[model samples]
Target: MKILVLRFSSIGDIVLTTPVVRAIKQQVPGAEVHFATKPGYRSLLEANPYVDKAHYLNSSLRELVQELRVEQFDFIVDLHNNLRTSLIKLQLGVKSAAFDKLNWQKWLLVNLKINTLPQVHIVDRYLAAAAPLGVHNDGQGLDYFIPAEAEVSLTTLPAAFQQGYVAFAIGAQHATKRLPVERIIELCALLRQPVVLLGGPEDAANGQLVEAHFSNRDAEKSQSRILNACGQYSLNQSASLVRQAQFVISHDTGLMHIAAAFQKEIYSVWGNTVPAFGMYPYRTKYHILEVPGLECRPCSKIGYEKCPRGHFKCMRDIQFEPFFPAAPAAAAPASQNRVG
Candidate 1:
């Protein structure tokens, strides 16, 4: 059977769909799996072994649809479950199953603060999309693949990080989703071990601020311990860093999921959003840190540029000690190729 799986964008969301791809390939007989994602995210699936073909979503949906029509897939698994996927299912006119996004449950929680969400993780929900195909969750957890050539070498990083470091993801898609710069600086300062701040080009400034704060505070010390890697590495390269770290401390973002793929110990900090959404670290060692019992918590289903309440107590009131507890005396050697 020739099967088409669709999850359009985002690093974490796309990564969450890997189990479904693998299940259809392994469990079903003679299944040729093709994955369709955004143009920018093609690399995420191209290197994946389970996906037989990787189709890109071009600027025009009509153009993309035409491309998929020629392939003539036997089944469509719509993990995205948005309007775009709906249109694709209509156009393709094929037997399909789609993930239930639980939009109504999320709305009730976000609006009325009512607890109606299921206890299941989003991965399990995603796997449900493939149930009609007789596929089940293999319980192996999430997967992220980095080609040998794309892996970041130890030499590329500073000598301080070359030995060992805790990967600290300092940026999120929204301000309300991440801690303020001052709080991040404090969090980094409290960490006992060497630190590597992770983010994209957009987060370079915040990474710099954290580095500078550490520099000024520890100027009398000998070596430069904090390494700001924001904008310095590609997404895969950053994943390579996360793969090698002893453990990861991250805001609610893509890297947090990437860390889970590596099975690294993750300390996930939550802000306006709560863990009830079921997007927390999947099948990995992790901890959730958020202010409990706040009436204004979960102000939005997604996040905002700034806190609507203006207080931002959900993030500001959080303490760092709970997130990064005391570490062991001796550091283990860093893994050469931790990326899978």
Candidate 2:
């Protein structure tokens, strides 16, 4: 059977859908799974062995839909569930299921602070979308496959970062989701291990500020050595860094999910967005550092370019704790999610 799974245009959201792709391939006999994502996200899925073929929406949706119709997929799994995917299913006229995004519950929580959303992780919800085909969660958590050719060699990094380091993913799609640069620098000062800053080209400027602060001779005398790897590595290369890191400190962004894929210890910092949104690190050891009582938080279901109330207290007020290489605290282990 040939099944098509659609989750277009994102680093983290697409990463979260990997289990659905894996289950459809592994559990369904002779199943051929095709994944649909935006052209720019090739790094995320191209290396995935379970994905039989990838359909990139590099052109118009109409054009892409025409291309998919030729495949004659037996079923459709719409993990994205956006207007575009809705149209694709309509055009194809196939049996399908879509992941529940819980927009109303999200609105209720964001607007009225009501906790009506399900406690299930979003990964389990994505897995449930495939239950119609007898696909079940493997309890193995998320998957991130790095091509052998793309694996970053630690020897190429600064000598200080060669042994072990903490990967600080310093970027988020929205500013409200990221800690301010000053806070990042302050946290870097608290870290006793080597530091590697990770982000996209857009985050290079902010990464530079943190890099410059740590590179100073006086700061270097007291703090861990820092390497600003912001725009230097591709997504997979950065994922390689995350895979090899002693621990990870990230914003609510894609790399955090990627770290979860590798089962890395993640210190996920929260900003305007709250963990109740169900996008927290799945099936991995993670600690959430958010301001305890912020009435202005969960400001938007997504996030704003700046805090809507202009206080930005969710990020500014989070306590910056120095990380120790001891048994992690707060977040439970991946084994606790032994059976999803």
Candidate 3:
């Protein structure tokens, strides 16, 4: 059977669909699995062995549609459940099943403060789309395959981090989801371990501020303890760093999901969003850090560039003690090192 799976964009959402990809490949006999994602996220799926072919929406949707029509796929699994995927399925005219997005439930939670959403994680719902093919979850968490060239060894980093370090992903798609600069500085100062900040080019300036703050506190120690890696590495290379970390401190962002993919102990800081939306880390050891019972919490389903409410207490009031434990006395290898 030739099966095509659709999850158009975003790093975390696409990464969450890996189980479905693997299940469809392993369970369905003679299955040739193809994944269609945006060109920017092509690398995420291309490295997976279970995926037989990788199709990217590089240009116009019409172009992608024409390209897909040639494959004559027997089935289409629409995990994105958006208008774009709908158009693709309508044109292809194949047997298709889409993951339920639970839009109404999310609306209720965000607008009316109703708790009608299901307890199931989004990964399980994605897996449901493959049920028609007799596929089942194998109990594996998530998949992220870093190419050999992208692998970042400890030796490449500073001497202090060579032993072990925390990967702090400080970037999120929206400002409200990230901790303010002062809070991040405080958080870093409190955690005694070496920290490597992870983010894209857009986060470079903010990363510099955090580095400066660390430097101002203690020049010699900050040099070894903090490394601003924003805009310095590619996505997969960043994944490599996350894959090797002792633990991860992250905002609700893509790297958090990547950390989950590697099954890293993730202490995820939540602001203007909550785990109730079902996008929390799947099957990984994690702790959600959020101010519970804030009326304005989850003000936006995704997030806002700035907090709609003036105080922004959701992010401002967060404390770090619960997420991070005390660091070791010296820069040494952590006792446990287990990764997928």
**Candidate 1 lDDT, 1-340, residue by residue in tens:** 9999999978889988888999999999999999999988877887899999988888899999999999999999999999999999999999999989999999998889997999889999999989999999898988999988889887877777788889989889989999999898777776777899899999999889888888888899876678899998888989999999988989889999999988998877999998889899888877776787899888887899999999999999986564445652223223211122
TM-score versus the correct structure, for each prediction: 0.95, 0.94, 0.94
Superposition-based RMSD of candidate 3 using all C-alpha atoms, in angstroms: 3.8
* Model 2 deviation from native, Cα RMSD in Å: 3.0
Deviation from native of the Cα of residue 148 in model 3, angstroms: 0.3
Clashing pairs in 2: none
Which model, 1 or 3, shows the larger lDDT?
Answer: 3
- Give the lDDT ranking, best first: 3, 2, 1
Clashing pairs in 3: none
